[model samples]
Target chain A: MSDTQTTVEPVRMGRKATQPLLIVNDLVKTFGNGVKAVDGVSFTISPGETVGLVGESGCGKSTTAKLLLRTLDPDSGEVKFGGQDLLGMRGRALRRLRSRFQIVPQNPQTSLNPRLPVRSSIEFNLRAHGVPKPERVERIAEVLEQVGLPGAYGDRFPHELSGGQLQRAAIARAISTRPELVICDEAVSALDKSIQAQILNLLAEFQKELGMAYLFISHDLSVVEHISDQVLVMYLGRIVEDGTGSQLWNRPGHPYTEALLSAAPGAERERIVLVGDPPSPANPPSGCTFHTRCPIAIEACSTKRPLLKPTAGGSHAACIRTTDLQQP
Target chain B: MTVEAQAELVIDAAGETSDAVLSVRDLTTTFTAGGQRIEALRGIDLDLYPGRVSVLLGESGSGKSVTARSILRLYGASAIIGGSAVFEGRDLVGLNEKEMQPIRGSGIALVPQDPTGSLDPVRRVGAQIVEVLRLHGVVDSKKEAQARAEELLGLVGLPDPVRAARSFPHEMSGGMKQRVAIAIAICCNPTLLIADEPTTALDVTVQAQILDLFVELTSSIGSAMLMITHDVGVAKDLADHVSVMYAGRIVEQGATSTVLDDPVHPYTKALLAAVPTPDVPRGNLIPIIGQPPVSGMTLPGCSFAPRCPVAQSSCTELVPELVSVELGHSVACPVATEFGAA
Candidate 1:
């Protein structure tokens, strides 16, 4: 927040034709003298893509989101958006970038101001981007219609609506300014499955309509699978695996990824059960972060850090034993 | 006289069946808020057979817990429960707190959600177990209570029972704390155990372990169980019988597989479709478009028609009661015969 310091990146802007709509490479962030909150994480999302970022608590998925948004300061690496270095933006430059990106944060009940009515909440986003008040009502109405709520519901307070309805109002607020990239942070985790389905469907529909991208963050794999075009699996402040939703869920490469999929309630995993809790991120293992809990862990996996490598297709996993990880 | 005897013989049609442990007939509870009456239950008819797991599945605010608390007489004297909830041929609905005290924790018990929260934070878990035993008059001696507590811990698959018995709730994991709650629920060897969202707070692997323990313990003791949960998957996997509740009433009831696999009521079908099943691949999911009616919400006909896709004009005008469709299946919907179940 200081005026003098700025978010500067070391890497040069890559090619323009296929620049990642959002690029987060080797993003390292730490808390007050704490361990790496986001350790060596990398992912890229193009236009109209929905990338699901999933993991259990303390997996640094939330940390990665903050880094991408530039709300939190990263110790190293770069966050690039639109073939432009996002890490160098300062003050007005950063504020302008924020207009292109918005976040519908977790827990709509607490996210939306209780004192403010739904109408005012929608108007705030438009006003922030200097949209005239005369046109606010029209833009708000369009977003509300997209989420399947009538315009009349706009004047009511968030408390007046049900949990499902309140979330729809939150979604309307996020996209009212038509941001190119939106961050849905556990947007539907608090909602019932039926309500979750509606929100996920609405997100997909909006992506096709607006050609926007999303950084979908959640611990629930079901929601991740339903909405995300590609998926990123994080554990202990690191991205364990990254690939298409099918390859990640149906055929995971990392030991941690397999454990996560198997841990799903009704997944019917092939009798593979993760025994111990994941190691603490603050005091992570020396080499492979997941070796402590890996079931088929090799001796090499414990002492030597493994670089993320391609496995079979447009998928990559960070593990030493490729043969063991590829086992059926 | 001979004709009267023959009629009585046919009236007792269900012969060779075991006597019901807890029978509820026409049970209903209403509340008066702001000078308006809110009917929480409308003539709930149910039976808890010995050693059977009867699941009451419903979404939030569906009166599932009200049914459980009503039998325990926990609604206070002002609740005005109608009809009878017969426990061992005794009308539990009419019993006062003093009269019901001896039965609770002795012949009936409850395993609530958040096992750690269920126990007193300041007291040691071992002492809490002993307190339950003393309350039920199962063991007057402290040594006897402690011994029984250790045994119960072992029964629920806890490791190092002696150490766990002395440990506090904070020292244990979520699964271990739930096991401690189970240990307390079965300490008195009650005839029935009521578990209300016992596994909701735990992870998947831990949930499975706790559920399996419920089956193992209830069967071993021949104690009937009443499990109230929002998850339909667990109901399918665990319950022998399932009762689907919506808008403070049982809309459907039958064998678990039959009810879940071929649900009749539109509400039941919608509720089942809501859960994201892993067996079913990722695709477009069918979600009920609208919210369930809040308490005291009423329409001209069916409660679920507001969100039901197949709702007809007639469905909005006339309320329907449970209609028998087969030997065990029953549904409360006018369009039950027409709706093609999933």
Candidate 2:
């Protein structure tokens, strides 16, 4: 009863696990012209918990993944993995930390080397981390099998495989390292519908068997709802809503969150389609960053940036006029 | 000549067929691979009215794209088309390439899946549009073509028509490139437009905008659109009528709202359930539970029977013809009567 009633997880990141696998706090990243690609984004994943980061394109969900993996440096914030603050770490420390967290990019076509055989590409990862020669071949085949690819695929190049098979190999290579957390950045976006279901099933089963956590980031609300435990909704580099998957899907708090959830393609829901593009983060809206597109926007929404406040439904929303939004 | 090859143009000499722009009848296509004949489309019948949007929905190998290619006669020597795909009153099956060339763009145009792969990466996007306009004899002079190209770029909602006219395909994003392709397809101003999964490569926000662009283009040009896609939600968003395809055949055809709100065919029902939606309460979306059969594989009974829940033994013994369920609703299944009724 409590788990269903509360949107936040009843168990908060399993305080007893062998240190948090990954932690991000007050993370901010800005591209050229001071466009904040990621702003004040924070979350945590325990040993085996999966947190879904959901948003539309340009909401900076992918940037959050890149920041945690250090593929892109954060302007200001903290990323602590395995109890070590990663922002200050450099050289071998950073490289050593990277080995503990792996990323699987969205498009396998672009990610995998089309010219190289998939087996060699997968084996390259393990060998770089000093995996023994004899063990690498067997482990490569085992991981490939784990992601539902046949063991015989070790001899085939990326071009020989279908889109589904190519994506499976991408997952196999990411897990070949046996990292503590797998950062799947829209991993299934490019796959077909039937193939998407198979891959999602593989990821779920892998998590249960290996006890690994996932920092899963995707724009697809339906996909996140099917697989995620805790769901965080972002807009313009900032988290505007965070709760359990069912809670966010049903009673979304922020207006931007409402627009995104209702706009999910597969199922019919009451939707408020916004008109304008998200204001550029370089010179974002004065108060609430979403005030430009907020349907029931108020005067205060233009002057004051509201802090993330707890609603009665146990979800958090960064909207000062959330309660009054319903009033005429 | 055989009746198949000798059939005359049935419509009046004025190139009219009542309200319909294209009327396909008993169209079947086959292919030969590795010394074996492969039946891709057994038989498909469809009608397209002027200025109406229709979706040809199906999974991979369902003959959705095959039907599109057959319409254009682009399937190469591997194909052997049967029956007739009539357009503008002529049976397209036996037409020579020289005869088909003039009819290709002036009568109908096709927009492919990935614009990046469709367009020449080395060439300028504007030049490509200009080539299509000139090839179709819509514009003769280069200056007039350039002027029309700028107008088209603006029509598709590109920010600056002048700059976009000079841009290469690589300079544009996936969404922008798709817009350029849409612009080119509409440049010829064909009576009908065939788009095959045009938004598959784009993001969700960009997808909505592109769908919006299609609606805008259709209404402004008043061209009937045959949108072939696997996304049923998109069918709901854009299609005026819908036909659900399976194993290269349409199992269900009806007005979009009636079919989506109350589908008669078992395959149609299963397809509706398979697509994941946000508003449907937390439960498993029971997909069709299997992939489409391969193109060359021969199916004895109903193509969807293996995955259908209420399949009977009789369903595997004979192929069922599409019987009318109600006005404007028809399904190719014996059990179709059980749907939308007590």
Candidate 2 residue pairs in backbone clash: A266-B277, A267-B277
**Model 1: runs farther than 4 Å from truth?**
A1-17, A32-37, A84-90, A268-271, A276-294, A298-301, A305-307, A312-314, A320-328, B1-18, B277-283, B338-342
> Which window of 10 residues has the lowest lDDT sum in candidate 1 chain B?
B1-10
Real interface contacts reproduced by model 2, as a fraction: 0.14
lDDT of 2 by residue, B1-342 (tens): 211111123334333544567777788889998988788888987777767798998877788999989988998677999877768778788898999988887788998999999999999998998998898889879999999999999999998999998999987888889999999888989998999999887766567778878988899899989999988778988898888898888898888988898888887787776555554432344545545666687879898888788898988889988777776777888875764442
Please give the RMSD to the true structure for each candidate, in Å. 5.9, 5.7
Best by DockQ: 1
Alpha carbon lDDT of each predicted model? 0.78, 0.79
Name the 10 consecutive residues with the lowest summed lDDT in model 2 chain A.
Answer: A1-10
lDDT of 1 by residue, B9-126 (tens): 3226332232567777678988777777777887787777778899999877788998898888887855768978778757888787889998998888999988877888888888
Quote model 2's iRMS: 3.5
Please write out the lDDT profile of model 1 over residues A1-328, one tens digit for every residue: 0001212222222323444578777888988867678987877777677789988767798888888888888989888888778988888888877888889888888888888889899899889887887899889888888888888998888888888888899889888888888999988887766677777777877887777788999887767877777788887888877776777766777777777676564455553555544566778888888877677887888898877666654467788765576545
Clashing pairs in 1: A7-A87
Model 2, B296: alpha-carbon shift in Å? Answer: 4.2
